[model samples]
Target chain A: MRVVVPVSGSDPKTRLASVLTPDERRDFTDAMLADVLDALTGAGLEPAVVSTAPVDCDAPVTVDERGLDALVNDLLASTVDEAGGALAIVMADLPLATPESVDRLVSTDGDVVLAPGLGGGTNAFVCRHPDFRVDYHGASIRDHRRIARDAGVDLSEVDSRRLATDIDEPSDLAEVLLHGDGAAADWLADAGFEVALTDGRVAAVRK
Target chain B: MRVVVPVSGSDPKTRLASVLTPDERRDFTDAMLADVLDALTGAGLEPAVVSTAPVDCDAPVTVDERGLDALVNDLLASTVDEAGGALAIVMADLPLATPESVDRLVSTDGDVVLAPGLGGGTNAFVCRHPDFRVDYHGASIRDHRRIARDAGVDLSEVDSRRLATDIDEPSDLAEVLLHGDGAAADWLADAGFEVALTDGRVAAVRK
Candidate 1:
């Protein structure tokens, strides 16, 4: 199985602009990408990064400047045409993703395995069927399910908090601080980010 | 490790009453329970059923007439005081749960491993820490997270569609028909329940 981690090397985590400067976002994104790569490697799978621009990582980086939907669709098409093996796509922002969780996502039997994000996005997925493609639009998880159904493929969903969480908003950082133990968590801690409870909700705040 | 599946044999799946009669609901619930037990046993875990009434199954059934929270808390306390081993609680309605998914739930290392349901419920959980208890109220997953945090235990959440999906509503049966290959799915199929698209949503309707 070939695993791919999609990342935006430039201007990543724009939703976190309120809490992070452009440089900090870029650094944090790299940290998260490193954590995801480590998790995939720990799971005994070699992962390559599909970034929008050049990234400094041990994994082989393929800079695809296209939009997410197009990039993923092209990857799916090429995987079908060339390798004809299973392809697993994991978002780079899921710092909480552990090796065990990644194993669960890949080990399950299905033509297409989807890891739906908390906010109705497709955070990660394993595509084993040639017909299955991705559409990363509004509620992409729902769209993926529909697409799988339309393609007449068996779909399995990996319900994992680790995979479901993508660090886009500032509030999402709290989850990384709380449940994460990888490079991203270390970066946040080094940057003086801590978990705080504001209005009965958890948030990551710099102290 | 001890595995316990709590079931309300008296009045189960009341929310599904609109579609099923009392006897049908009882039978359906039993089928789901059977599937859950099969999954647990398949995962090499001996699971006992803690039910409000007698249930005809291969596993040992402990008739506990207490509420869900009380029964689970009491079980947690006993497991701490006597067994000194981990306790895994899997709800009866998760027909989609396969042995692989169950293995992922129990195999993960954490003091408290939570599998949050689709509708803010804690469907299945493995509790290794003595201080961890369950509260099956509104948004119990959130409460469990908070409780684990307060108890200073290492918390791990398993995001699995198989574990997260509990059949409580009529619409939920579509998932069983689609993804489940267990006794519960067979039961629903035998009952002539088929997946129907209603209002752009998948639903289980009788032919």
Candidate 2:
């Protein structure tokens, strides 16, 4: 099975002050995707970064050139078009996103799986069939499950720290900061994120 | 045992936005302090809010016109003077503060107890003796323990939610928001804090 992470540069909740510059955003996103690729490769599955913009990586990096939705559909379609296999569409914002999480999602066949966010939104999605529409936005967990049920695809839900953690908000950043060093951990740490956190820049934004 | 909670106007993190009116700051402080009170109350201790300025509370309130350290010492002296009993000095900030936690700390009354926060800071101190000079600032947990040990006061470490959480930033707000509605919750609900939180205003403060 192949895993494709669709990263959005947008973080609805950004805690670290300018933690990512435009250049850094691309680099950060690429590094996160690389971590995912490394995880997938470690698990014996093909992994790729599918973004609207191209990213340099050891693994294949495909630029959708299209929007996020189009990029998602394109990635899933390419799984069948290229390898004739299923794909898992994951959000790139998750700092804790790990290969183990992706493997678990893509391991099952003929089924759709989802990992819901803390606020009841779908953070990760997996589908066995490419025909499953990628309508994962705004509390899409329920919608994806319904779609899976209607399509008669086997359904499952996973509660995972990796999947649950998508760094989008200030609080999310706190979790990322609190997360003992990992793939995305260094990115924040190297940028003096901890200083801003301890010094209260993050708290100021929160207030 | 008598408990002393010192409320201060000086913020170490400088996270509060200048856009907020004086009323907003007061409300914010009140909401934050209320969370601490709720936790202490939940722990079955009679929580007293000792403020450098007059603080509004449903619980007993004490105004400390002198200074934070002096007020704290006075409160501690009230319980631990030559004739005094056990005293716990709590700081007003932790939103995840729970009463069950304080109970656990006080349960070991014979020992000098210290609850540490992020980076070796003291959140609350329970001392059996009044002669011990309490330093409730800057690595105070380590300082207090050392002081207690030097004074021959049995030292104990109580790792509780009360000791771990102190809302100084936006990240800390998540716990207060996520936890079941408390006094802070009510104040937020009344002041329409949900508008900012739900509308992603809270998310905007991120780095």
RMSD of each: 7.1, 9.9
Q: Model 2, which residues run further than 4 Å from truth? A: A1-207, B9-14, B189-207
Candidate whose TM-score is highest: 1
- For each predicted model, how many residue pairs clash, with residues at least 3 apart or on different chains? 4, 14
Q: Candidate 1: lDDT of A41?
A: 95
Per-residue lDDT over A58-123 for candidate 2, one digit per residue giving the tens place of the 0 to 100 score: 667666656766677776677754566667766666655555655665664446677655443567
On residues A1-207, what C-alpha lDDT tens digit does candidate 1 reach at each position? 888898998898888889899999999999999999989999999999989999999899999899888888888888864678888999998888889889989998999999876545688999988999888865576689999999999988775767877787776787777667889999999999986655333467899
Maximum-DockQ candidate: 1
Each model's lDDT = 0.85, 0.61
lDDT of 1 by residue, B109-195 (tens): 999999977545788999988898888776577789999999999998776767877888776787787667888989989999876
Provide per-model DockQ scores.
0.13, 0.05
Docking class of 2: incorrect
